[model samples]
Target chain A: MSTFYFIAFLSIFFSILVISAKNPVHSILYLILTFFTFTIHYILLNAQFLAIVNFIVYMGAILVLFLYTLMLINLNKESEPVKPFMVKIAGVFGGGILAVALASSLKLVAASNPVILKNPDLGLVKNLGKVLFNEFLLPFEVSSVLLLSAMVGAVLLATKDPKTA
Target chain B: MESLTNTIHAVPLNHYILLSAIIFSIGVVGVLIRRNAIVIFMSVELMLNAVNLLLTAFSVYRGDASGQVFVFFIMALAAAEVAVGLAIIVMIYRNTNSIDINVLNRLKW
Candidate 1:
């Protein structure tokens, strides 16, 4: 097998462990590994800018927040309860159906021809930065507004009850 | 025609598709099976990532930049999703000390 397949297998394996792990903290840590693998995949795909952003936003900021949240709710023991076996089986069935449907639809919907650019080395960051600033400017700014609103909303929710203080 | 076919067989699109399918299924399983809100959220991310993988594979097969652009948007959306999702999880945790999504049904009037 190729290195790509090896990395891909490792990514899938770690992500599965992430969801199945009982400890929330451990799950989050595993999720970091999952994100790292995604970054590798992005790099392989020549999306250099996205890989860096994944490292910074997901591994750096989001995982830190996950750890902080885990620390904040330090219960005496693990809090999430396990579901019954039947429910799990049902879940597997439901998820299976969805996956099959999605895959089939994509296959049926014939895609357009690939457009491999002659200059694949046009630095992703530079090109994306130009695109963001030029054509995608409005949407980019709107995203900032959306993020600020989410931040404010989170703070409001956190401080709603004085008793929790 | 035989020689052309032999040369074209080097890159298999099926491999990428199969891998994407597995990732998507894993995400779906996590969402359906787990009760923890965080894990479910992560599973959702997994599903999104799986879709992104499929998009990338298709883009490569077809030689399109648009698929990569779509992946870019998906990543932005995933970050936004995580921010909102984590906040909601925090709120749910404070209201009740458990992240078990099964109990979220009790929030109904």
Candidate 2:
């Protein structure tokens, strides 16, 4: 339980750092840390397969792509024009209202004490794989198709004609 | 394993829900406050992750594998989103020499 609190605190802290950092590169690094903490949260929830997948997909692949783009573009503090002070205040106020609304709604949820199983292995790779393949075969195939289309779309959007440029 | 589960269950599920809500709100603020397109994109990812954490928590409480399966789909979607979205951002940068989304408001026609 203490471990959960500690990691949760770290995740929140890093998430703040992600948004607050002036440097986009530092924001990306903090985002990586946030993802790492999320991976730990997955493990704590007994979702080991997801923990590993989150590490690889988020930390290794997606975040690295973000870093690469940021580096390629070379955006610095000077390049990022600051938002007006009024806009900043409004943003914070809006976010605060959202948090309050969500937290309050959560309080209304009737807590159902679930039967905790001893040695629940649902998060194991073997178990998750079986479920995913058996029950989720269609979605699995669909996701592959989605990935293919996304790849094609990205290539199309990024490619430029020499004559046009 | 049992001890770990026990420890996890010791913390009430509401705590997790609250934590997720807080993080989600932070992500929202990031999106609203930041001017950088990449930073906004990162905030959107943070929001997705917050939902993922909530889903995983509910899955644990309900002893359901479906939620985890959904998380799998979300991750895939996120990967695809980042890929295509970044490509578009790069394209925009190529055209405008800047990644600020505000500068792209010339489509007022």
Candidate 3:
């Protein structure tokens, strides 16, 4: 129980660093730490499959890709755009108000029935695979299409076009 | 495992909701305050993750695997989004030599 609190604090703290870091490389490294904490949270929840996937996909693939791009562009500190101070304050105020509103409204609702983990093994890969293939077959297939489209779009967008340039 | 249910019982569901809510709000503030395009993309990922965490919590609480399955799809979606989004950012950089959102406002070089 206390482990959860400590990990949650680490997650929040690292994510804060992700956005607050001055250098993009430092931000990416912090983001990796943030995702690592999330992986731990998944383990704490007994979602074994999700934890591994999050570790591989998020920390391994996605964030590494981010780091790669940050290197490719080599955005120097001078190149980093700095918004006005007033805009930043407005952003924080707006986000705080949003959080307050959501918290207050959620508090108004009757307390939800306590959670009970009925199936301890429900988060295992086997059960999740069964549920995925059996009930969510179409969506699963559609997601492949989505991936393919995204791939093609990314390639097309990334390739240099002699005609346009 | 008895430990599974025990851990879920350890942390109340409300705490999960509030934690995710705060994370999501931080994502929002990141989007609003940051001028860099890539940071904005990272912020969006943060928001998606908060939702994924909440979904997993609900799935565990209800003993339902479907929510986890749905999270897998969201992960896929996020991957695809990052691919396309970073590609767009790269292109923006190639042409404008800058990946700042404010620079793209005019929509014309």
Residues B24-104 of candidate 2 have per-residue lDDT tens digits of 999999999998999999999999999999998888888888889999999999999999999999999898889988998
Model 3 Cα lDDT, one tens digit per residue, B1-109: 6765576566878888888988899899999999888998998999999999999999988888999999999999999999999999999999988888898889774
Q: How far is candidate 3 from the true structure (C-alpha RMSD, Å)?
A: 1.7
lDDT winner between 2 and 3, please give it: 2
True contacts kept of each: 0.32, 0.69, 0.69
Which of the two, 1 or 2, has more lDDT? Answer: 2
In candidate 1, what are the lDDT values of residues B4-105, reduced to their tens digit? Answer: 223323335665676678788888899889987777887887888878877866665565555666677677766666777777888888787787787889
Instruction: Report how far off residue A138 is in candidate 3 (Å).
Output: 0.9
Give the worst 10-residue stretch by lDDT in candidate 1 chain A: A114-123
Write one digit per residue (lDDT tens) for candidate 1, span A48-102: 6777877887789877877877787664486568899999989888877876876
* Poorest lDDT segment (10 consecutive residues) of candidate 3 chain B: B1-10
- DockQ score for model 2, please? 0.71
What DockQ values do the models have?
0.32, 0.71, 0.74
C-alpha TM-score for every candidate = 0.83, 0.96, 0.95
lDDT of 3 by residue, A67-105 (tens): 898888878746587899999999999999998988888
For residue A91, what is the lDDT in candidate 3?
95
Task: Give lDDT: candidate 3, residue A79.
Answer: 57
Model 3 regions lying over 4 Å from their true place: A112-114, B1-5
lDDT of each: 0.72, 0.90, 0.89
